[model samples]
Target: TITEICDRYPARIVDVGPKVAIIEMVGTESVLEEFIEEVRPTGIVEMIRTGVVSMGRGTRIHDTNFINRRALADAAAKADSGNGRIV
Candidate 1:
């Protein structure tokens, strides 16, 4: 199972359980669609996507967006105090 996924696509296993496996493949949209088609026969229970994260070719730093560490910590603390809700 793992070998087939690895051979067909450069996917990283996120989690594995008795009935499902979550994987992530970082690549072009076409490649991602093709991989989905290839894996359709194996039963996909659910899929979640965070949208495209992109950068110019040959750039120095990754083009990821992130909250400041302190801001994140503050939000987390608020959520914890608010019973895990982000309000």
Candidate 2:
């Protein structure tokens, strides 16, 4: 199962929607390759590599909650009006 695989690897399940799921994992190249191979049979539709985190460079946190809320509100409005466009 995916849960078991995640528990065994250095992976974390970030979100699971009705039709999609997002997972985050970090490790060496070999470890990542092995993990991917193990999960290839689980019907993965898409994979996106966002960015690399470096300890030497530290990390910057962005407060994007408000932006997400605004986007969600716009999407809801569009849906309610049957326009299919976010304004």
Best prediction by TM-score: 2
TM-score of each: 0.54, 0.56
Candidate 2 local lDDT, 1-87, one digit each (tens):
777999999999999888667889988878888989999998889887645666433232255576688788888988878876545
Query: Largest lDDT belongs to which candidate?
Result: 2
Error of 2 at 53 (Å): 4.4
Number of clashing pairs, model 1? 0
CA-lDDT, candidates in order = 0.77, 0.80
Which residue pairs in candidate 2 collide? none
Q: What is the lDDT of residue 32 in candidate 2?
A: 85
Residues 1-87, model 1: lDDT tens digits: 754865778788888888888787888778888888888888888887667877566543453433366678899999999999987
lDDT of 2 at 5: 92
